[model samples]
Target: MELYGLVTLVGVFLLLALEPVLARNPLHHPRLDRWCNNIGLAFTNELIRFFLPLALALVAVDGPWQAFNASSLGLLWGALLAFIIMDFSLYWVHRCSHELRWLWRLHRTHHSDLDMDVTTSFRHHPGEVGLKLVLMSGFIGLLGFTPAHLLTYVLLHRCFALWSHSNIRLPEGLERQLAKVLVTPRVHQIHHSAWQPETDSNYGQILTLWDRLFKTYLSPDQVPCPARFGLEDFRSAEDQRLSALFAQPIR
Candidate 1:
């Protein structure tokens, strides 16, 4: 578990370190730029506030499949099953985070950045990150998943998320075909759009099925918001961080 955590954290760092090459344009906001100054401060505070509580919750809980004694083959299959189940769970979690008000508060932190890139993936408020960990961890325990299995599932999803954030566009025809299986970059991009219709749609992360099932799916062509990204009211990037962590709009 610790090893997997290290790998995931390192993956985030690698994305941050390679931001220049991976981003579509030069990154619009620096990690410590003037506009994002409050963002970093809030991030540090939220991490301390949330992770400490989350750690205690996880320690008290029993992980899934904690009691099973199985053969090596069984373990492999168990892990595979675990990954699939977790992916489904994450799909719903991501969707709900957008639909619900409180969850949206934390989720907004990640979306505040005008530039949607891999670094944006890690720019989440620590509180939001901690909440997700708790939710995923509980789901893991409830599903009887092993630590190894959880780690594998986490890595796979992280990779998918990074892919979704990439600046590269998918061929329109190809993206439509692939959305039937996994989420394409085009499909996920709609979720990042600052437009009202676009912002509330395309809630899936690794899979597009949930949005389809829930009727939240919107095609890039039909709801084509091919305009500048980011919130309309918050014009300047300076307040992106402030609004993200502490001042959610009363809409």
Candidate 2:
């Protein structure tokens, strides 16, 4: 667990610290908004996720021992299985975050950003992270995942998610070819598209197959080119102001 924390902390720090300077595009959100979400909320959510599971899983699980049991599939296979499950779980969670009105209250802060960048990856609300933590706790416990296995899968998917959100777009042919296996920027950018159809499609965060399987997949060529990005209802200026933006009502 200590190493897990270290891995997450170091990875997040490097990405959040140097991505702006490394990427060619200018950082879109103000430094304050970026820090507030990436550093402030990240720390807060980390603490919440850490503690919440201890309590929530106590009565919730059949037994903690059961949760720690090894998968007969072996570590490598267990890791792969965990990765697929986590990605599928997150796909539904993200889709519901958009479709459900109340859930959108906690999730909308992320979309409020008009500018797409790496730091934008951490702009989610603490409430949303809390909900995810609860869901993750249930998922691991019910599925009998050891902490090591779960962390491996979580780290893999999260790294892909951060990479997908990056301002550094991939070479043209690369994204199309890779979308056959991994999630690519072009596929994910469509998820952030301002248009309704594109915005609702492409919910798969790590694997491209989930969207295709579930009928939400829209190829980059097929989705309309959004004239702009961000939530359909959000204005660029007001969305920059963190306090006012989070407090805005969903229309």
Candidate 3:
């Protein structure tokens, strides 16, 4: 699991470096400081996770209903089922983070970024990470998923999270087709729009199916205008600081 995590981290770092250089309309504003702050926040979340590494394992169920057990549904089918279940769980958790005031307070730290880049995917507040860990552990335990299933989902989840937040522009046709099945960058950028309604939509982390199923999906054409990313309340430079980001959930 640790090895896979390291590989995903490096892959995301490479994407973060390459995407903007390939972007057609990359932000002209200076991003170094914001990138540093976002990375700092990510590092803090990792530190928290390191100490709480067993949260998922501890909550895992070992009963007869273990769906992912090799003797039951078989490893392949079990993994696939577990992945879909977890993805669905993530959609609701993400949606609640916006609808519920307390969760939104922690979530706003990620939305506070003025620019959307690969690094922006890692801008989650530590509080949000803790909340997600608790929620995800419960979900995993309830569903009887194994360590391998969780690891597979984590890799795919991390990849999509970074890809959806990338600054790179995809070929129009390709992006359109991809958005039908996956959550593409164009689709996700709308979610980060400073406008409240847009910000509240596109809550899916991996599959776009959940949003479509829940009627929360918003296509680019559906938007009234092109989105200006970031939270209106956190537009000031001072609010983008690492210290301010950590304090945002309470303030």
Per-candidate TM equals: 0.72, 0.81, 0.91
How would you encode candidate 2's per-residue C-alpha lDDT over 10-41 as one tens digit per residue? Answer: 76667666655655245544666655545555
Residue 179 error, candidate 1, Å: 2.5
- Residue 171 in model 2: shift from native, Å? 1.4
- Name the best candidate (by lDDT): 3
Candidate 2: Cα lDDT at 243: 62
Runs of candidate 3 exceeding 4 Å displacement: 50-54, 63-71
lDDT of 3 at 223: 69
Worst lDDT run of 10 residues, candidate 1, spans 64-73
Across 187-217, the per-residue lDDT of candidate 1 in tens digits comes to 7778888876788887776777777887988
TM-score: the better of candidates 1 and 2 = 2
C-alpha lDDT values of all predictions: 0.63, 0.71, 0.81
lDDT of 2 at 110: 73
Candidate 2 weakest lDDT stretch, 10 residues: 20-29
Model 3 C-alpha RMSD to native: 2.4
Stretches of model 2 off by over 4 angstroms after superposition: 1-38, 50-73, 236-238, 245-251
Global Cα RMSD, each model: 4.8, 3.5, 2.4
